[model samples]
Target: MSDNLQNDNVVIESPEPVDTTLPMVIYALYLASIVTGGLTALVGVVIAYVYRGKGPEWLDQHYRYQVRTFWIGLLYFCLSGVLMFVLIGFVLWLVAVVWLVIRCVKGFKGLQEKRSPENVDTWLV
Candidate 1:
């Protein structure tokens, strides 16, 4: 009786497909921004603006990540230049780059695995 009642009005709706490319695009823009600030940051901004309407929370998260990366890189770069030791800043910068790369790859893998959001730190960034 209970089983019949539960099935009588059940409705199924298709899930919306998530776009995975946006994150990759953001990561590429982030790398470019690091290599060439100002211009590259502008390029990143343009990309973000163009794709702002795309689906899924991941896109927004990636956009935020790219913007954060750009500002942090710029700040540390200027500070490093002024400080003159330079190597420390450069090393820190390299670490950030490597971390992002690793994170991007892991993000792809996570998408493939259909993992949960709590697993974000596995990407290492």
Candidate 2:
């Protein structure tokens, strides 16, 4: 027998349909950032930026929300860091953590329901 054989015809399958997978993954990454020291959140925000405007309008809303969450969260963190000198930073840090959790959870729920996030423009949950 020959070492290799040629086929006369080949078939290829189409890719699976797109869904909320990316959004869910991003949310998971954001949550994991709590333990990962914000590294995962940086990755999640990059994914959100890269995939933004490339899906259904609803998904676009999610991407936008994710992007905003990253920037706003960063601002909160920085502010809290500066306030650390005054001792109020501890409280602000806790508030920031809670805010991030609420935002991620809300986004996850919206994605699960296949709907656009409510008040996507809001800074608070």
Clash number for every model?
Answer: 0, 0
What TM-score would you give candidate 1 relative to the actual structure? 0.55
RMSD of each: 5.2, 8.4
Q: How do the residues 1-125 of candidate 2 rate in per-residue lDDT, one tens digit apiece?
A: 24334443455778656689989999999999888979999999999999999988888999999999999999998899899999999899899999999999999999988888889999898
lDDT accuracy of residue 78 in candidate 2:
89
Candidate 1's C-alpha runs over 4 A off are: 1-11, 34-38, 49-54, 85-96, 99-124
User: Where is the poorest 10-residue window by lDDT in model 1?
Assistant: 115-124
lDDT of 1 by residue, 2-84 (tens): 99999997998888777666656665666566566546656765776666556566545555545555556566556656555
lDDT of 2 at 100: 93
Q: Evaluate model 2: give its TM-score.
A: 0.85
Give per-model TM-scores: 0.55, 0.85
The Cα error of candidate 2 at residue 53, in Å, is 0.6
Residue pairs in candidate 1 whose N, alpha carbon or C atoms collide under 3 angstroms: none
